[model samples]
Every structure is written in structure tokens, then in C-alpha cells.
Target: QFDRKSQEYRALKRYWKLIQQDSRKLSDKRFYRPMFRMHLTNKEILEKLLSYSDELRQHYELYQFLLFHFQEKNSDHFFSLIEQEIATVNPIFQTVFKTFLKDKDKVLNAMELPYSNAKLEATNNLIKV
Candidate 1:
């Protein structure tokens, strides 16, 4: 049986290869390195992730710069830019999104009905119309 540890190691190995070939313009290069380093317990891996996140996000060829940075000068402005990018990209996922825009405890408490009463209200409005 393949253990969970083995699986994580395999994922890490795949992650390293993904980073090393980041300049090759492979389809996986854009987001693979940060995703891979996200789970590691070591500082080196974390540094790699941080560096790659900055470098790739600044790169002109990839979509990362287009999303989070662009013409924005500050991190807050950049994050606001990213929020708009996410909203446009995933219109159907507003509630999963509110989870971030709102307080976590509140977001989790409201999770039970992101679509419940709202749908009924819309249905009632349609029926009246």
C-alpha cells in the first residue's frame, strides 16, 4: 500500500521538477511551484515558493502579473485587483468568495445557506411577476 508520506514525497518531487523547468513555458509552470511548496515544512521550500510567487507574478508572459499586479503599486491595491479578477473568473462562486471578503467565523456560520432563502425570494418574485 502506498503510504500518505510516500504520496506527499511524490508530490514534492513532481513539484521540484515543475519549478526547475519553469522557464520552458510548460502549461504547468505558471502555478505549479507555489502550489507544490505550499505544503512543505522546511524554510528553504518556503523561500522558494515566496521567490517564485514574486518572480512569476511579475513576469510579462504569464497571466499572474495580469491578475494580481498589473499597474497596481501597493499590496492592498494588488489584492483588490485580484478580487476583481476572481469575481470575473468565477461568477458562480460568490459565496465561496464571501468566505474571504468577510470574517471567517461569520463566513463559516453563514455557510449553511449561501443559496437557500435567496433562491426562494427570487422564485417568489418571479411568480408574482
Candidate 2:
């Protein structure tokens, strides 16, 4: 871990936004080319930041899993396991989990189903308007 007052800690704070961004959306040249201004690629920055702490690495892995693996058949089970595992990792995660638990069935269904009712909801809203 880095000392809170160190230059490395400040750099980590500056780039913290990158941690939650979807990697696929960042594949475009325009999206990633700006990192060159600092002479550090996104991958390199993430590697350096993640290397600082085991919990941060685990959090990153969990975020990636939530983004990419939610469509799998066993996703619901995995999601529950992840919730349990991260229960002590961070308080923010626990808050998010509580929100998900409120709509747990709907959340699981969204993960399992390929199609969404978004269009239907939009049409309903249009009709109401």
C-alpha cells in the first residue's frame, strides 16, 4: 500500500475513474489515446494500481465478472457467492448488494434472459405521454 501523502497515492486518485469503465468501450483509439499524454497505457496504470493491494485486485476482478459474466446459466449462484465473499471487502459494495437484493428476482431474470422489456417500457411511456 502507498502512503496517503505520497505522489503515487495522488496519481492513483487521479486515475481511479478508470477502474470502473468497461474495457470494450475503451478499445476505441480516441478513448484510449489520451493515456499516452502521461506516457502510461491504461493497462499499465491498472497493473500498477492493482499491485498495491490484494483487496483492490479482488474488487477489480469482481467488477469485471459483474460486467462480463452475468449472462451465464450459473450466474445467479455465482453472484450470491460473490456477494458473500465481498461482504467484508467494502461497505459500498454491501450497500449495492442490498439494493440488488430488493429486486433480486428481477436482477437474476435479467441476467438469464437474452431479451429485455426496455422497448416495451419505452412504448408504454410514449403512449402515456
Candidate 3:
């Protein structure tokens, strides 16, 4: 049995968020440090957690692979690989896979585009204010 309130558990939760973070937009490194001072690196902590469950480790690996493809803007490959791999792994991912397929063009474009309208939108909002 695992104690959810344990320091290790808190560190594991942070680890989940860290792995998905885009390096370009990563926050202060100290913000992601473990709940308590520890000699172990984040990688070491993550490896320890992953060792606890094979199923969890498999899901994490799949997630990492998909994220890598998406981040690298391999839109076509991401779509196909996600459908073939992610959909079969779990019901939650099956839902996500279906949603991605439904908006395939938009999703792919977002991934391929080097820029976003976020700044323009912010400026527009400021003018209207």
C-alpha cells in the first residue's frame, strides 16, 4: 500500500507535470524540486516511482513518445501513431484519440505552425479595455 500523503508521492505528482512541460516554457527549476530536500535527482525519483508499476511505466512511455512527435511537429506521424498506439491502450486515451481525429486538421496546423495568435489576441483585448 502506498501513502498518498508521503513526500515521495508529492514528488511523483510534480514529476508527472515536469515531464510534459515544454523546455522553452519551463518554469523556475527550483519550483519543481521535491517536497523535501533530497539527494536524488528528478530522474532518479521518477525511475523509482516507475519501478512501482509496470502498467504506469508503459503509459508514461507512450505519453512521452506521443508528446515528442507532437512537439517535433511530426503531425502526420503523430496522428497515425496515436491512433494505432494510444487508442488501444486505455479508454481515456481512446477518447482523446477520437477527439484528435475529429479535429485532425486544426490540431495538425496548430502543431506545425511556428507562431500563435495569442499575442495579437492580447493586444486586441487591451485596446478594447
Q: With candidate 2 superimposed using the best TM-score fit, by how many Å does residue 65's alpha carbon deviate from the native?
A: 2.0
Number of the top candidate by TM-score?
3
Clashes of 1: 0
Model 2 vs. true fold: TM: 0.61
**CA deviation > 4 Å runs, candidate 1:** 1-13, 16-75, 90-97, 104-129
TM-score of 3: 0.69
- Which residue ranges in model 2 land beyond 4 Å of their true spot? 1-5, 23-38, 71-74, 113-129
The lDDT, on a scale of 0 to 1, for candidate 2 is 0.71
Against the true structure, what is each candidate's TM-score?
Answer: 0.22, 0.61, 0.69
- What's the distance in Å from true for residue 23, model 3? 9.2
Better of 2 and 3 by lDDT: 3
RMSD of 3: 4.2
Q: Find the 10 residues in a row with the least total lDDT in model 1.
A: 59-68
From the highest TM-score down, the ranking of the candidates is 3, 2, 1
Model 3 lDDT vs. the true structure? 0.72
How high is the CA lDDT of each candidate model? Answer: 0.45, 0.71, 0.72
Model 2 clashes, total count: 0
| Top-lDDT structure, candidate number | 3
lDDT of 2 by residue, 22-120 (tens): 655543223343433555566677776777788888888877777776635567665776667656758898777677777778887777778888999
**Residue 123 of model 1: what lDDT?**
94
